[model samples]
Target: MNRNLTSQQKNAVLLSMAQLIAAEKAVIIKANKIDVESYRGEDIAMYDRLKVDEEKIEGMILSLQQLIADVDPVGKDLFHFTHENGLKITNKSAPFGTVLIIYESRPDVTVEAAGIAFKSGNKILLKGGKESLNSNLKIVNLWHKALIENNISTNWVEYLNYNRAKIQVFLENPTQKVDLIVPRGGEKLIAFVKQHATCPVIVSGRGNNFIYVDIEANLNLALKVILNAKTAKISACNAVDKVIINSNLIAKETFIKKLINKLLKFNVEILGDVELSAFENVSSFDSDEIWFKEFLDYKIVIGTVNSSEEAIAKINKYGGGHSAVIITKNDKTANTFMESVDSAAVYQNASTRFTDGGEFGLGGELAISTDKLHHRGPMGLQHLVTNKWYIYGDGQIR
Candidate 1:
């Protein structure tokens, strides 16, 4: 079991980490370049996440800084009770002991996830993909140095440089205690972790997000939100994959045509249902199975729904449970859509891209969880903790 550190101790380490990352930005970038060059996969989204640049370096530093500023989540009081016999009981937030995060492509998770776990007083075991070995190793080196500088154990953040077979073995029979496992990649990775790990798993699931343009929607706003959500960052998990337009929408054809044209400007491939297939450049999908797909690319599907109820039902049925957006001027309709959509994050007349930890003001997040138990949305520092019960008694018996 890992002993909890004082808030001051954790903050000191985070500060040191931010300073070191900023100071060694060049070295980090150089190491990242090696990882980028070695990656030969044709996955555009994976490639985008694999490459680390100056902007991403700044982002790492900022995440650490934010963690330093946020309140420590460990040992906070949750509930208190007093008994007639002078026995006292209290519940408080506690660390999960150890968190094993298995992630891919994104090296920044090295900084963000570990920092969040440490602040919550949990030891983090990172299992980064082989594609980002060099970059992740470099960041882990910085984490070690920061720990050493703060007179803390480097065991707080350890990296598992293992392949798929090794990871499976370790998960099936962990040499060390792993209280919780978080899989931060795609469906396959999540499935693998859940299959092998004996511990509880928090699934960072896919984002087959949706946007519904309602009859009362501001068509221009819908277009803007859709374009931004889809094209601004195609590699993001919150990127829009499907857009459902109300069948009764006034000037619906004009709006759809405009949306298609706007998307085409960015070289996005437009796919549609049978009704929308007549539009130029819009290819019709053969099956409804495509609705369940999370296209982390410059591709989108446009479909039509008869009413808000249909839209809600379809989104709940097909969406990734990550994010959904409803573009409408009617606050009542927006509220209905937002509440009906079964997603981690729901929006009204806003881009789905804002389904992020930083944007949601959690400072930063360990993961954008899709699970309902324990947590449902952004798993920030405060959300990373489990609870413990404390009892005070002087030889009291039942």
Candidate 2:
């Protein structure tokens, strides 16, 4: 922990990492292709996450570059004060010492999350899903090369190629110092980590996000926002999985028809609760189980609420607490909805897709946290640290 590198040294490593990625683009793509080819389409969400292409590679490079450009997150003095007893106390941000990120698919996380941890002065332990082993190994190798080029230790970013049994054992009794564990996949994954981890676990919980359309909502705006939120990236945690429309909405039937037709354009499978199940082209939800599902697919559920209070209650009951949106022109209604919804990110007249860290202007994120301990939103470069207090005294003691 005492081996701290200067900002210039860290930036050099990041620059080298970017250059290495650009130079080895073809190799990385080849590895990703092997994983993509192995896909049998058994799990659509996993398949989507595992596949990495040109754009994802560019995104990885950009994440590294962004971290290099941002201010050094460590060593910032948070508070400094002196006691009347001639004692000085200083509080400053410090690295978590080590951060373990366990994720499924998403090979880009190997670069982006590791980059964030590295820039924040935390030694990152990356345990990626086995499906992306080929790609992850290659990327971690590049990171090590960059660190070596900058005369830094490769321990800053270590990759753990462990099977499920090994991972469970490590979590239960780690030989290493695991300061924090972030599980960034499905509910089962998050639950597993939480069950076994001896250290604090930051849950990157699933996004069963919801959007409520009030009576005063602009139909056009609602359509646009919902379409983008659902179709833009069906696999994203920020994608809208369910919608609650006001029963008193003006031309409610017409709006429902429009929503159904638009979703049909993207082949989105529509399911509705009892309130909307009678409508044409909408199927009834299979039990209340649908309410708790994080549909990271081309599927969505539509329900109805008679009042804003009802909408808020329904969301708080079933939503994942990741993000919630309200499409209402009335400022008062929007404020009430935003304030009442218990979510990490609340939106008014906007898409839930903006819940992403990069989209939220954080450059990149380790994950979108639903936990309210250290953080509740995107775990970005700045959110990755804890703090330390330094007390100084010459002849004073407490």
**lDDT (Cα, tens digit) per residue for candidate 2, span 1-398:** 33587888888999999999999999999999998887666788898889888899999999988888889889999999999998999999999999999999999999999999988989999999988999999999999999989778999999999999999999999988999999999989999999999999999998999999998999999999999999998889999999999999989999999999999999999999897888888999668878889989999999999998999999999999999999999999999989999999999999999998788878799999998999989989999989999999998966
Model 1, runs deviating above 4 Å? none
**Over the full model, what C-alpha lDDT does candidate 2 score relative to the true structure?**
0.92
The whole-model lDDT of each prediction reads 0.92, 0.92
Q: Per-candidate TM vs. native?
A: 0.99, 0.98
Query: So what's the TM-score on candidate 2?
Result: 0.98
Which stretches of model 2 miss by more than 4 angstroms? none
Worst 10 residues of 1 by lDDT: 1-10
Give lDDT tens digits, candidate 1, residues 117-215: 999989999999999999999999999999999889999999999999999999999999999999998889999999999989998899999999999
In Å, residue 226's CA in model 1 sits off its true spot by 0.2
